[model samples]
Target: MSENLGTMTDFSPDDSVMLKDVLRGLALPQKNIPSLYFYDQRGSELFDAITELPEYYPTRTEIGILERHGAEMAAALGPGVRLIELGSGSALKTELLLGRLEDPAAYVPVEISREHLLAAAARIAADFPDLEVMPVTADFTEPFDLPEPARRRVERNVAFFPGSTIGNFPRGMAADLLAATCREVGAGGAMLIGVDLVKDRATLERAYNDAAGVTAQFNLNLLVRLNRELGADFDVAAFRHQAVWDEDAARIEMRLVSTRAQRVQVAGRPFEFAAGEVLVTEYSHKYTPAVFRSLAEGAGFRVARTWTDPEGLFSVQLLEVPGAAQDSSGGT
Candidate 1:
């Protein structure tokens, strides 16, 4: 067991930057906020609770796929691989893959929430004493340096992005992010990602609009974050959470609708909201296998393999860079 806990890159946005982004989003025609803001301590906790709700099936389903096929997935990446996970919330599914990997070089968990990332990283280090745990506190969508393992030599970097979080980005942005990840991992590297599949409208809507209202709290917590962090005077109670399935977009849209006309002040700036005006919070896009393959191909990755549950409601895909030199000893 190595004592090297690994290094952290603190690229977290400052309060001023957050305020600027919040103000900019509020000024948009759609009046949107970045979904990343929903990960404050309370918001993160709320989301963890939402995952346990019966209506939310993605988490459990994805976990089942990882549990059942993690060994195969690990074998695909092979030995001496560096695993970098994006948006590693609690890293609950990560253990399944990490435990199965053969002589993995290191584990890097990238997250925007510093507190959450540190906690998860610490736990992983304590549990996997032989594995180097490098945690980066940054928005994974942005560029950040992958930490070098102090004790081990890695063959290639394999990004482990689970939880269908890639759906949070719009198609174009998602493709761009995938391209960026491909570049970061280099030519021989690969990525293992979880993607939610397009399902019936009822199931999609129910997932976001959980009966327990925990999802609602998770959505509204964005406003709570704005009020607390940016000194925004938002009438949080005056807004209602709404999740709708957009057939044309093949996505679930989460919004906060103002119940009545209201004025809110943030950073001493006033913003007016009409009674029915909506503030877009997030978008979760579901895709068919062909659609996801096309998206990854456009981003410079070839779809190597895909694993899905019996119902095909979600998919865990293995994406690899093409025409790269192979390590003969590594898993194929």
Candidate 2:
């Protein structure tokens, strides 16, 4: 095993409290749950499969963005950056990034799953032997403290939030992530975030609702998680997968609608949803070039550079901290 950065860390109570608040939105009675919890080990493996599916274009498209801009992008980060990755699942996209970084201090992969986090950190460390690998097992949506030595050595914390995961959150949480990362990494550093761009709803819907049924399995897996962890009796098979594009909202929404009205027991409590009641599983908010930059600016990030794929399916934008100065079109 590659050595951890002389320090290993876990989430603090603050982190736990914040995560519960964000995730508890599921109980709202009108909406479905967020698919974030689908990342627990098995779900992570399923996602790895989902990335390889023919319909899932975001991963490969985002990879293309990195490949085209990787070296230039790395140079743009300035020298000797301590790269921190949020939701660092498998670190597949990030391996492309590490190729471009001019090694400085350490690499911190912050993942809620300790297993995935350590496995990825270990693999990356083997490749970048000189770069210290610090893995923090904690939820990225919540506040977390980095490993002791990792925190001490961080000169500039460059966070790589790939996978367009920002779309999963509502606008408020998205804003909070931007602000929180800025506060955590503090001023001067930058955040390279992957965002899915506004595209034809047909294309968007197909990507999430693949013919191979991997996305469906992934969506349904959340119910399995809730059942196991929360003691809920979710007859997951009784749900139908639905993907609808909300054009006005500029996002693709995934839902699990009940096939029949049924009462389900969760955490020793029972609740009923009428047939056709939708459980919103995920929302993939697609952004235009302008709206995206405005969002970062709203949350204290100065937009630096935006890289997109040749087909315009996805975007990887770099935002500077303490906010970026504005030009007529928005941050540069």
Candidate 3:
């Protein structure tokens, strides 16, 4: 890690709280856990691996769009803008935009895993020596403060939430997060986000269930995480990973199915799992351009422009805050 990095937080995660979350999820009628817990240092590495798998099209597709239109996107946002990225894992795709940003004043990456966040921030600071690299260790779903320098050094801000992360949230929660981001970016600012477009079930399911089993590992790693941090006695081999498309919801759901009836103990409490039971781990909702635009508009932003690959597998949209000045065409 680079000590010269602009600012890296020293936020220690609360293990007791994590234990509580795990036990509570296990006790629920339909057991489920927050996806945020899946990013311990090891889990983070597994996720990075998942992104590289050939079956994972979102990462590559989003990167392709950024590489092709980075200059245009940067120019549209204008010069000296403070850039805040939510759930900025690895921040690999961000470098493409950083190169095109016209003297951007600061780069704030908000992430949940402290170790991963700091490591990424260090690398970014080293790569972009002149740009401020501030990493905030917090759940992006909740409100968190940005580094004071990032706010003080620039007048206009743009929250860059790439990777189709907003899809992980339910529709209502997604809107709330977008609205919160609008408040954080404030007036005269904007947001650049990625969204996975609705696609065929076979393709969507395949993406989440790669032949290499990396996605399954990524999902099961949650159990390993619970075992390690929450004292949960979960037999990793007793459950199997599954990914299915919910057509009506236009989403992909990741779950771990129990192979047989089982009982687990976490935080000194026993939890029962019936045969064939499933623990819902994650949901990735796909959206059409119109649906996404409605979401942005509902959150007090105007969809300035949207870019996608020819296949339309993913979308990157630039949303301007209500009062932000824009090109006559409405968006840049």
Best by lDDT: 1
* CA-RMSD of model 3: 3.8
> Global CA lDDT of candidate 1, please?
0.89
lDDT of 1 by residue, 1-332 (tens): 23657767787788988888889999998899999999998888898899899999999999999999998998999989888999998898999999999999998888888888888898899989999998888888877777778777888789999999999999999999999988777778899999999999999999999888999999989999999999999988999999999999999999999999999999999999999999999999999999999999999999999999999999999999876734412211
Of the candidates numbered 2 and 3, which has the greater lDDT value?
A: 3
* Consecutive 10-residue window with the lowest summed lDDT within model 2: 323-332
lDDT of 3 at 67: 95
- Of models 1 and 2, which has the larger TM-score? 1
Residue-pair clashes, model 2: 2
Looking at model 1, the pairs that clash are: none
lDDT of 3 by residue, 1-332 (tens): 45447656544458877777777877889899988898988889999999999888999999999999999999989887778888889999999999999888788888888878888888898998878787788777765566655323575788899999999998999999888887778777899999999999888998999999998888889999888877789999999999999999989989999999999888789888899999999989999999989998999999999999989999999998877533211111
TM-score of decoy 1: 0.96
> Worst lDDT window (10 residues) for model 1?
323-332
lDDT of 1 at 63: 94
Off by over 4 Å in 1: 325-332
TM-score of each: 0.96, 0.90, 0.94
